[model samples]
Target: EPIVEEMRRFLDKGMELQRLVPFAEVMAELAWLGEGDRDEALHLIALAEGLAPTRAVFGGLAAWRRLLSPESDPGETDGMAEPHRLQLIGDWRAAAALWARMGAPFERALALLQGDEAAQREALDIFEALGARPVAQHVRGLLRQSGVSGIARGPRQATRANQAGLTQRQMEVLQLIERGFSNKKIAAHMAISPKTVDHHVSAVLGKLEAVSRGEAAAAARASGLV
Candidate 1:
């Protein structure tokens, strides 16, 4: 209750700042917390929908919320609900790919948990590797509930390359920048025009929140991204 009240305040602050994503994210987290509290969950979902630019593209957050509705409309998402439908029918492996492509990590993990025993283990491993203690515990509990066992606790290594949400070409350009290459040199290596490389460099810098190439390169190297 206290957390809910605090989150409401945070939501207000985000609104005041004209930043909608935090409101949507907080609503998603609240929805997840409410779980079987359908009324509360739907209320949170409505709030998120108001903040979201569209019914899509808070990635799968809106889709996940839509799944919790008592009266579902398959047509509402324009076939986007197919993944959830597949997930419901024990075809979660198919759904997992969609979630992964959508960059929805939580949805991907959920789909994987329902896919198969190996995939369930994989979901747990992913949670553990991310140091997502609550989610990992939840996955482990789910396995125990289903009489599943023998999950190997392998090394926890989350790939950080392009973790700044960089595209493949941006990642390549970033690596070159870290190696002290100029735009022309990077263009020659990638066989693209210098103008294209400049765009990518600017994109990479913006994504990394760096003011200059040097700072971005230093950040990439420090974060093991380069």
Candidate 2:
């Protein structure tokens, strides 16, 4: 998915502008690093920096720029947040531990992706378990670049066979839908990207043969799938 598209989803959810500013920075950084849209990334970075010109945010933007052009020094990490500084400095093991303590599985996995092959493998598993296909693909690319062999070429088998073909993440999304949780709520509860939640929701609807979330919930209850 386009980084801007995901960023737009966050904006459409009516979250606080302050809370969303960081995500804009994150998506901009991802775009710069992950073969996403450079022009959009620059636009987003400009917008976010204009909105929240905090030292922490500036440090993050500067760090990402340094990553893109390694010869330029990534100046002092004095003002950057601990997690952002750790990940940008390639100390992903420490960053992963910090995210784990904070109960952010997706972020922890992202940090792990910056570590050794073993750590990257764990990151891959976490991404797949969360149904974050885009990040999982990115992790796969990293593993391949590191000369690791025998990586699985598809979703885990358990994800394919569980609960009438509902992946574990999909089942979680379905249960949340049954409880009338919006996609944003489900994303928050699962600690995964809203984009991943969207994919799971679509899959759940398709597998349950329902036209809407309410109908899907009713079918799931009628069939004991939830």
Candidate 3:
């Protein structure tokens, strides 16, 4: 059931791309089949044929036909065609490795298909450095399934403390602090008086339960508040 849900999510993302109809159609068929709904699978194949008149769709539909009828032509399963093969013949190893590190298969595959390997790797590295182990592990399993490999492991876990809420003004102040702006600089940038900036900073610290501005900034980052 988990695999089915995962495949459904993958198909959803593929459909979102709009241009990758062959991949999207194939995944849609796989999702329906995973759920043991043969009628729905055939319906999706017909939809795919309408959406993208390509050999991939024909191949996929043929595969489904064979599934529905065992004595169907053996020529239907001719493996991935040239274009689809070219699409798949990419840096899957690196993609898998990065996804493993990030602990997100769906995101990794999307990035790889979009040719955003560097961004994917950067995200994984950040996740590792921040000790997001559960996310990393989940990504690793996804990467393995996608044929990605050789990912490096880092810190396994990190404690995330709950953060106190801040008003919009306090949040603004914290963003400036994270930017290494002095109170005076923050005041100038925000068009507020220095004294007002100081007051907001103090309120931010108090509400966030932090003794220092740096701690407030770090807390905001961890909580995704900034």
| lDDT, each prediction | 0.64, 0.70, 0.53
Ranking by lDDT: 2, 1, 3
Ranking by TM-score: 2, 1, 3
TM-score of 1: 0.44
**Model 3: how far residue 202 lies from native, Å:** 0.4
Cα deviation of 39 in candidate 1 (Å)?
4.3
Task: Name the lDDT of candidate 1.
Answer: 0.64
* Residue-level lDDT tens digits of model 1 in 1-226: 3344455567666553234445444545434432224455556555555665543443354445544552454234533366775665456788899888888777788788766789988888777667665456546656887898775534443466534556566788899999999999988887776655766787678668899999999999888896
Worst 10 residues of 2 by lDDT: 154-163
Ten-residue region with minimum lDDT total, candidate 3? 156-165
Give a tens-digit lDDT track for model 2, residues 1-226: 3454566677778755565666656655555435344455555555655665465866556545544454655555667888778877778888899989998898788678667888988988998889776567656766788799999865544432253556555677888899999999988897766765776787678667799999999998887776
Collision count for each candidate, in order: 0, 0, 4
Q: Residue 2 in model 2: shift from native, Å?
A: 12
Regions of model 1 farther than 4 Å from truth: 1-7, 10-24, 30-39, 47-54, 57-59, 66-75, 79-91, 98-107, 149-226
TM-score of 2: 0.52
Give candidate 2 misplaced runs (Cα > 4 Å).
1-23, 26-35, 46-52, 58-73, 156-226
